[model samples]
Target: LRELKTKIACTIGPSSGDRGTISELINAGCRIFRINFSHGNLELWKEWTDNLRQVSSSLGVDCVLIADLRGRSIRFASPIDAKTYSAGQTFYIVRHDGREGEVPSVDSPEFFEAVSENDVLVSDDGRGLMRVLKRETDKIMVQALSKLTVRRGKSLVIRNKEIPIPNYLSHCVDQILDAVRLGTDYLGLSFVTSPRDILAVREFLDKNGSDIGLIAKIETISAVANVEEIAKVSDAVLVARGDLGMHFPLEEVPRLQERIVGTVTAIGKPVIVATQLLGSMISESVPSRSEIVDVMNCVVDGVDVLMLTGETAIGSYPVETVNWLRRIIETYEGDVRTRREISQDQLVDRFALGVVELAEALNAKIGIYTKRGNTARRISRFKPRTQVFAASNDPKTICRLMMLWGVEPIHVDSKEYDRGLEELEQKLKEQNLVKRGDTLILTYGLLDKPIHTIRIVQLIS
Candidate 1:
C-alpha cells in the first residue's frame, strides 16, 4: 500500500459523521474528506470539521476537506413527486394561478420566450414534457404529456441541446464565501461553462488570500467543449456524470470521460471520475463485478483519486463501500505506476527531494518536521515509496497530512527535536509500524521551509 500511493476520496454525510465512523473510513482507506456544500451550511460544516480534527489527531493522518456548492442553478423535482414524459410527446405549458398541474408562473412576463412548432420543453427529465404548437406574445399553446406536474420556477431545459447559463450567477457569491470561510481544502465549481467562469472562481479565492484549490466539475456539454480552459484553472477535475448524462447522449459519457482524463493529465492536474461509481452497491453489501472493474480501470487510466457518491454517504452499504474503495487504492498503490509517471512540474521545485533520493540509496523511510501541511504534499508528489513520518507540533497539520498518500503524520513537541537515533528508533518501534531491523531517515529545520535541505539520518531499530 505504501508503494503506489494513489489516493481515494469519499463523501461525508449522515451515514458516516461520527468520530468512530470517520475512523472507520480512514481504516477503510479514505485519504480525502469531501463535504457537500449543496446540503449543509456553516453551522453544519463547523461540527463536521471539528469531528474530523478529532479523528485525525488520534490517527495521525492527513485528511483533505473539499466543500462542493450548488449555485442559483436550477434543480428539477424534489424526489417526492416525479413524472416522466415519453420520447417524442407533445405537451402544453401555460402559466399557473396557484395550481399544481399548470406551468410554474414566473415573476416576469418576458420569461416565456419565442417557441417554434414541435419544440419539446422538459422539466425534470421527461417527467414534465410540454410541446409548443403556437407561440403567443405572453404565453405558448402546447400539448401536455402524462399529466406532468411542472413546479414553480422549474428550469425548462430544451432536451438534446445546450443553454447559456442564466444571469443568476451574481446571487451565488455568498455561497462561495461561506465555503471559503469554512477552510475548504478544495472548492468544487459547479456548472462550469467556460474559461471565464473558472477565472471568476480563482479571482474570488485570490482576493481573500485563501489559495484553496479548485476542482472543476464538468457536467455539461458546454463544459466538455471548453475543457482545456477549465483544466488549466483546476487543481483537479471531476467528470460529474449525473447532469452530464442529462445534457449529452448518455452513451457518449464513457468516451467523454476518457477525453477529460487525457486533457487534465496532459496539463499535469489530477482528475477523478465521479457520480454513480458505486451506485448499485449502495444497497447491496458487496459491489457488483462491473463496478469493481470500473474502479480499477480508472486507476490504470491515471486518475489520482476515486470518489464515492451515494455509495459512501447515503447508501445502505456506506461503510462497506469505503472499505471496498480502500482495498482497491491500496492494491494499486502497491504497484509501481502510482509514482512512476510523476511530472517534476507538478511538484514544488524548492522542496528537497535530495534527502529522499539519498534515503532511496540507503533504503530508508524519510521523517519530516513541519508547521504547515504544504511541504508534505510536495514531498509526496515525488512518489517516493518511503515510509513517511511528519512530526509536527500542530494537530491540524497531522490531520491534514493524513490525507496525503503514503505520508504518515506524527506529532512531537518542540522539545523532542533533541532526540537522536535512539529516540527515533524508539518512536518508530512504539508506533509498531516498523520492525527492529527497519531503517529510519529523519530531516527538519527552524524555518526557511520545504527547501530546508533535509538533513539525512540513519536510525536502526
Candidate 2:
C-alpha cells in the first residue's frame, strides 16, 4: 500500500490466532500483536505466541507482540448477582455450599465476615458499586449507589477507594514475566494508575533480566490525575478510554485523553489510544464513521499508536478492520499538508548538514532521500522544522522509520529516476510527498548511483 500511513496495533485472539489470519492482519498494516492475559490460560497464550512467531518470520515484518497481564479480578460468588444499585439496595451474594435451592444465609459467619464497613465493592467490571455501611459479627450493611447485576465468575472490584494506590488491578506481575520470557517485545500492564505502579512494573521486568518494553494502561482517576508523573516513568502509555470513562465522568474522558497524549508527546515517547475505536467491527465488517473521526482526532493530536481492542480480539472481521484502519489513516494523513518542523539542530554528518542549510537558504521543505533509513534518522536527530519525508525504495525501511520522530516515509523505485532531478520532483509530487507551491529539499546521490555531490535543496512550485 503506497499510501499507507499511521502505526496500527491489533490484538490477537481466538479469531486471529491462526497463521493465515495473523498474516492477513500484518498485511492489513498491523505492526503489533497483543495477547491479552485475562481471556485464556497460559497454554493457549503459548500457542498464539507460536503462531505470531511463525508469521513474523515468514513475512520478515517488524511485528511487536505485547503480553497483557491478567491482573487481580475480584468477582461475585453466585447467580442472579446484584451489581451497582441505588443509595440503598440490600443485596446478598451468598457463597455456594452446593445447595440445590433457596437463598443461602446472609447471616452466615463465613460470608459476612469477609466484608467490612467502608469497603468499596464494585462488580461487573466496575459497573456496579457499593460502600460498606454497617458491620456486625456475621452481617454487614452497605449502601449501593451503582447499578450492578452479577453472576458467578463475573468480576467484583472491592478496593480501598481512599487508599493511596492507583487501582485494584490484576495481580499479575509473575504472569507478565511469563509473556516477557516468551520473547514478546512489549509488556502491557493493565489498570496502571500512577507513576509508582509503572516504576514497580519496570523494576520487576529489569530484575527478571527482561529487555521487553513496558506500556502502562491509564484507566482511572488516579492515573489521569498523575498522568504527568506516569508519562515520565513509563516507556509508553495507553489512553485506555474504556474503563477510564467508567471510572470517571463521561464528559471528562475526551479531555483526559488529549491531556495525556500531549504530555507524553512532550516526553518524546509513544502514547497509544486504545479500546473501542472500532468496537462495533467486532461483529460487523466495517467501523462507524464516528470511529473514523476518533482515529483522525488521534492522529491530529499526535498519538503514536491507534489501537484495536475487541475489534481484533474476538471480532469476526479482525483482518478487515485492520485493513480498513490502514486505509483510513492513509487517506486522512494525506490531506494534512501543513509542514510541521521538528528540529533546528545539526546532524553528525557535515555533508547532510550543509545540504540542509542549503535547502533552508533556498527556503525549501527538506525531503531526506533515503532507502536504508539512516539518512532519515540522522535528519530527525537534528530536529528541523521542515516536514521530513523519507523517500525510500524499501517498504520495510519506510515502516521502520516510524520509530523516529517527525519522519514520514514514502516508497518509490530508486532506479527509475535517480539520474534526473526533474523526474525526482515529478515522482515526489505524484506520490503526494510534496504539493504545488510547496518548497522542497532533496537529499539524493550515492557514489554507487554515480553521483559525488552531497545532494542539494531546491524550491518546487
List runs of model 2 lying over 4 Å from the truth: 72-170, 334-461
- Candidate 1 error regions (>4 Å): 1-4, 17-27, 40-62, 77-80, 84-162, 166-171, 180-184, 205-211, 225-232, 262-268, 335-405, 409-456
Q: What is the lDDT of residue 369 in candidate 1?
A: 70
- The alpha-carbon lDDT assigned to residue 147 of candidate 1 equals 59
Model 1 TM-score is 0.70
Candidate 2 residue lDDT tens string, 193-305: 66767777777777878656678788766777888888777666888786665566557778989888777665556678888888789889878989889877876665667
| Tens-digit lDDT string for candidate 1 (86-111) | 54554444444444553334333333
lDDT of each: 0.65, 0.65
List the candidates' TM-scores in order: 0.70, 0.67
RMSD of each: 5.8, 8.3
